[model samples]
Target: MLRYTLMRLGIFAGCLVVVWGAVYSGIFPRGFGASNGLWVLLLALVLSAPISWVVLRKERDRASVQIVTKVDRMKANLDANRSQEDVADDSARTQGQPS
Candidate 1:
């Protein structure tokens, strides 16, 4: 998870730097005195999504599988715990009844 997150962050930062460089270098026309900061960030995010999707496919799949496995394990543990509780309850009720 940490590795995946860091990789994503690195991609976003790279996109941001490239976009900023374009705006600073006048590659992207800036009619106003300074380029809009929010617009630049938004463009970077938009550009990063497809790039990340392609570059991080393996890491994304690994993270997804890990999530599914954890969920399945949790469900199994919960079912087991519920069954034990039900058995204990049944035993206690049977003991209280007259033989």
Candidate 2:
């Protein structure tokens, strides 16, 4: 997951550089005055999204599988713990009852 996130960040940074270059060289129009930086960031995000989607499909899928496996393991552990606790509680209740 960390690896996938870093790869996505790298793609976004690359797109940001390309977008900045285009705007700087006047090939791409900049936003009004103070909004120029926001414009570049937004364009970078838009461009990076598709590039990352195409480039990172495998990594994304692997991360997703990892997450699902982790969640399943946690759920199994929780169910086991609950069952153990219930058994302990039942034993304690029976021990306290009259003969």
Candidate 3:
């Protein structure tokens, strides 16, 4: 849980850095002064940030499903191997018994 939290924080910081850089570069032109452009940029961020968050959430969910699938496959393989060992053990025990 702590790892996940740290990872999320890192992702947020990286995103903020990228967004700040883009806005500071004056990529979006406004007829008025920089203040108006900054306002527009902030508004766009407020609006689009949720959309970006939702998209990232979806990606995280997909990655989670893949991880779960891999884990389940590993568990199933382990179970099968255990059962085979049990069968072998049982065979050996019976073979040693009196005829």
Candidate 4:
């Protein structure tokens, strides 16, 4: 997960830099003034999404599998603990009753 997150952030930063350079270099029309910054941000977001989706598919899948495995292990541990407690309770109740 950490790796995937870092990669995604890196991709976003790269896209932002590219967009910023393009806008500043006059490749894109510059008459929007304050809105030029907004345009750059929007362009970066749009460009980054598809790139990340294509480039990070494997990392995303690995992270998802890890999460699912961790959840399953925790659930098994909880079930085992509950079963032990139930057995202990039953034994204690039986001992208290007259033979």
Candidate 5:
């Protein structure tokens, strides 16, 4: 997950640089005086989103699978613990042990 996050951030940073260059070269229009930086950032985000989505599909899927596997493992552990507790209780009852 962290790897995927960092990769996405790298894509965004790359897009920011490209957009910054375009704006400076007059290929893209700059924002109204006070909003120029914000404009560039937003444009970079918009451009980066699709780029990251397409580029990072495999990484995203791998991260998702890791998460799912971890969750399943945790669930299995919980089930195993519950079964052990049940066996302990049953043994105590059969032996007439106190509660």
Candidate 6:
């Protein structure tokens, strides 16, 4: 988990480096007379972190819910199996009784 986290952070930092490099290299130029195309790129970069976080959170929640549902189903099946066994045992005991 730590390795995965570090890798993800590294990739995010690499993207920022590449973007800034492009701007510094004059690949991104001024536009609408106000902020510039660089401003738009920066905004997109800033937005990525929050968006990724929200998406991950939602997926984790969904996975947790699915896991809980599966566990409940398994428990219910076990209970039913136990009940069936009990019924079979009762029937056998009655059959073996002296008339």
| Candidate 2 lDDT (Cα, 0 to 1) | 0.99
Give me the overall lDDT of model 4: 0.93
lDDT string for model 2 (1-99, tens) is 999999999999999999999999999998997999999999999999999999999999999999999999999999999999999999999999999
Off by over 4 Å in 6: 1-55
Model 3 ranges with Cα > 4 A deviation: 1-53
Model 1 lDDT per residue over 1-99, tens place: 788999999999999999889977988754344547876788889999999999999999999999999999999999999999999999999999998
Give the per-residue Cα lDDT of candidate 5 at 30.
96
For the record, the alpha-carbon RMSD of candidate 1 to the native fold, in angstroms, is 1.8
> How do all the candidates rank in terms of TM-score, highest first?
2, 1, 4, 5, 3, 6
The TM-score measured for candidate 2 stands at: 0.97
Give the winner by TM-score. Answer: 2
- Least well predicted 10-residue stretch by lDDT in candidate 1: 28-37
Please list all clashing residue pairs in model 4, or write none if there are none: none
What digit string (tens of lDDT, one per residue) describes model 4 on residues 1-99? 999999999999999999899889988666476798789888889999999999999999999999999999999999999999999999999999998
**lDDT at 97, model 4:** 100
Pairs with backbone N, CA or C atoms under 3 Å apart (clashes), candidate 6: none
**lDDT values, one for every candidate:** 0.90, 0.99, 0.67, 0.93, 0.97, 0.68
Clashing pairs in 3: none
Clash tally, candidates in order: 0, 0, 0, 0, 0, 0
* lDDT over C-alpha atoms for residue 32 of model 3: 62
Q: Which portions of model 4 show Cα errors greater than 4 Å?
A: 29-33
Instruction: Give the TM-scores of the predictions, in the order they appear.
Output: 0.91, 0.97, 0.50, 0.83, 0.82, 0.48
Q: Which is better, 4 or 5, measured by lDDT?
A: 5
